[model samples]
Target: MLRPFLMFASLAFFAFSAPVQTPPPSGAPAAAPAPAVPADAAQTPNPVKPTAESQARAKQIYGYDCALCHGEKGDGKGDVAADMKTPMGDFTSSATLKSMTDGELYYVILKGKGQMPPEEGRAKPAEIWNLVIYLRSMSKQ
Candidate 1:
């Protein structure tokens, strides 16, 4: 009877005690409320419209090497355009770049056009593909 009474008293005491509130796990930080901002700032920037990785690669190569002969924006009005004996075609014209295929452009890049030196030793096949993508992008079609 004494043992049973002692057990009942211990159970009662434990039941009356406050519940143990476990703290958050270690290394975890409490989240803070988000700050309010202007509605305009909430608008995300325009997504990249390149649409394809190849197009992006082409733009990169054009900016690096061809931009001198072809404008940085491919307007065909690059800095070297004036000095070059054979005028570089205006890429922004749309009609010109549209007609040519990736193969044709690659050939020109490899063989060089008029005064434009062949990049045979300088650029690899993959790099030339990028240039083709950039040229195709210039076309309106």
Candidate 2:
């Protein structure tokens, strides 16, 4: 369908573009932003290994879609978040991501929570999983 195609195209465009980094007006809590998810999904483990290719692709995708609100460095201080007055969790901190499994993160991306939009139609499950890996890698930096 055209809708699916459009979604893919837009996603591709964002993936190819550079990310914008802007600090949020204020700091957000170090608390985990774990949205509600089914236990089964939350327990799901990450299948994809952290690789240069996957991380690169995930970075690209995050740059376009997530960086707008989640920040370029995953500090949760993107320009959009500042304007929206959103308290996005900082991925740079270990505590923020410690309690969340890769599956839980994937669920949030696939289904979306709060103002976040689901990547369901726009990206394949593999890509979403890869994104989870990329998010986990943020704390290491």
Which candidate tops lDDT? Answer: 2
Looking at candidate 2, the ten consecutive residues that score lowest on lDDT are 24-33
Model 2 scores a TM of 0.74
Kindly report which residue stretches of model 1 are placed more than 4 angstroms away from their true locations once superposed: 1-54
Worst 10 residues of 1 by lDDT: 41-50
What lDDT does candidate 2 reach at residue 72?
98
* CA deviation > 4 Å runs, candidate 2: 1-35
| lDDT of residue 126 for candidate 1 | 72
Candidate 2 achieves a global lDDT of 0.88
* Number of the predicted model whose TM-score against the real structure is largest: 2
lDDT of 1 at 4: 98
Q: Give the alpha carbon lDDT tens digit for every residue of 72-115 in model 2.
A: 99999999999978799999999998988888899999998876
lDDT of each: 0.65, 0.88
